[model samples]
Target chain A: MSSFEAGAAGFVLGAACGAAGAAALALANRRRLGRFLSFAAHEINTPLTAVNMTILNFISGALGPVEKTQEPWLKMLREQAERLALIVGDLRDFIHLRLRDGLSMHSESVDLTPVLEAAVESVSWGFSQAGVAVRTRVDAGLPKVLADADRLQRVFVDILYHCRKFRDSGGIDVAAEAGLDGRIRVAFAYAGVKSSARESALALDLYYPARVRKDQLLTATGLGLGVLRLFLREQGGDLSVSNQPDGRSVITADLSAAGGGR
Target chain B: MAAKILIVDDEPAIAENLQAILSAKGYETSCAFDGSEAVAKARHEKPDLILLDVMLPKMDGFDVCRLLKSDPHGAKLKILMTTGLDRMGDVEKAFQCGASDYLIKPFGSVKLLQKVEKLLSGA
Candidate 1:
């Protein structure tokens, strides 16, 4: 080979090696971050659990009352204890996402309607507290989908959490249907858009919007959507969002029929 | 009378575990879960010392501490803020809000007992 050709080949080889090294480093960094987050979660979770329990016991009469002279101080201590637990829980969940590996699937044939209903029920208290109305539209004859029960529950939880964040007093609509390709599509629609940004704009590529400018939805960190996407992808499913002209946002998840087996 | 201690947090297992530990050490232990109820119980109980958590629903620990310290009736109570936040700012803020001292979470039983003993002795 000519010297020029030899040099060109050498350059190509060098570039390939460089790329491989970069990829390896990235993977290592990611794993390290995951481990760090897991450790952090444990640290926060343990104390949070303790703090939460202490408060519960106090209220339940497992611990008796404070004296009249010390009443004001005791009350303040109690409130602060509860707040600490909330912050710790949020931090732990967020860190878990950062440190988690891609979703680990354990699929089985499952009636998804009940799962969705449970999701709705789980958040009903928060919805009522926030004054939001929730509605459902599961097809009567919808086929059971193969899915990881835990992950599927998480998907619904994410959607419901988003709906609760954005809309107050307005109604949320959840509907499921069978697609022509033997896939099941579940959609969550709220009456108002938290943002006018198109569904594509909500793509996972972009970090959650810095601020939710839309009036209808509560401000969200978008971490929930990111985690939901990971879960869906593991089950051979995909999640997408669309912005309707009437200022509504519809989030849909499509799951393959193959996802139903154990 | 032995000094009574109130521990306010939201996690049940932690509370139960700690109750066992402290009760064995001969401290009269009481617990509470949320801010609103914690306040109610404190007013009723008047614990000798309080182990307070910083983050809470309805009201936060700082505000709770401030409310208590501001009240003449509650001003004498010794408040020790306990939390997982190790940030210097959080510690400073806790002290600024009238917390007598601060303890980081995941503390060993020995450390907790030691701190409790110190606070009780000082009081």
Candidate 2:
């Protein structure tokens, strides 16, 4: 065969091999992703179902007339139910965004402290029940941010949930500050780490090596972080993570100031 | 007195609908939104019957039922574990957790009322 023909033949063969490898990788990724999605849905659904059932019982007076002593428990139940509902709604929206079109951003002036406080409070009871201590350093006079409230809440909840998983009894610190160029930055810092295969599998993107235990391996379905990034980007914000020198990990979210536009 | 029943599920629409149907049949109704609250209410109200759901936040229905059954004051209250968990293991777990009866989700209004009546009548 002529040298030119031989080179062309080699090129075609290489192209075919590359295409097959790509297809195989894609298939494997899809299978892994499917399992992750199913597991996440199950984990999320269990809590949601519980919340729903509890609400039903309360409304039906199946628990009896609300007594003065039972009011605090009732309030906690309601708040937790709302929190779970919001998380479920966020997950559903994340799925829809993945399967359908791009996310559309709806920006508004939102008080960052109240939103963060509510998010923290919603999950506080569960953490306390598990013996996890939480500490907050939110700046009182932090400037408002221009962002979608729902998306921001989802991001905050995701970070808080992951932090809770790692630090059982340690404290979680959440702080916000006005950054350069009219940007508002919020950070969550957590100490210690749970080195579990199951947790590694559930870790979102921007996972820090130091944040994870040395013996722990990392795996993810990539759906949660993927949706989170999409939502942030649509809102002209950014999400990032870093392992601090103090054996702690910090996840940061930056958004434009209330009056600032990107 | 006609059986006083408490339906403890979080879904507002489901709770309201169940209350309307049960109340129409002369069953006094009360509700609680979560497992912890359900336990408190059950202790206070001492309803003759409870329609509980398995999936609940914080404590969950099984734990609530267990707590209720273990309590001297709440042991007499009949609990029907009403939930979407139709699996055999789930049903078995409900029974093991002190549920007097188990009802799967999507149960018709007629069937629900019938079951409630049967439980109330000591069947």
- What's the DockQ of model 1? 0.08
Candidate 2 on A75-153: residue-level lDDT in tens? 5776566556555555555543553343445668988887888778767777776676667776667778988775687
Q: How good is the docking of model 2, as DockQ?
A: 0.03
Provide C-alpha RMSD values for all models, in order.
15.3, 15.3
lDDT of 2 by residue, B1-120 (tens): 778888898766566667877887888999888888898888888899999977777788889998899998666678988765212246678889989898865344566777888888
Report iRMS (Å) of candidate 1. Answer: 11.0
Off by over 4 Å in 1: A1-23, A50-101, A194-200, A203-206, A210-219, A222-224, A243-247, A258-262, B1-123
**C-alpha DockQ of every model:** 0.08, 0.03
Model 1: residue A3 alpha-carbon error in angstroms: 12
* lDDT (tens digit, per residue) of candidate 1 on B1-123: 778988876665665666766787788999987677677777789887888877676787788888887877776888888876323346778999999898776444566677888888984
Q: Which candidate leads the pack in DockQ?
A: 1
**What are the per-residue Cα lDDT tens digits for candidate 1 across A1-262?**
9999999999999999999999988988987887687677656676555654454445434456646766544445544453454344444445545555632346778788888987787566556656777888888788888787645875686677776665534778889988877789998888654454544445443245454645424345335465466557767788887766776778888887644421
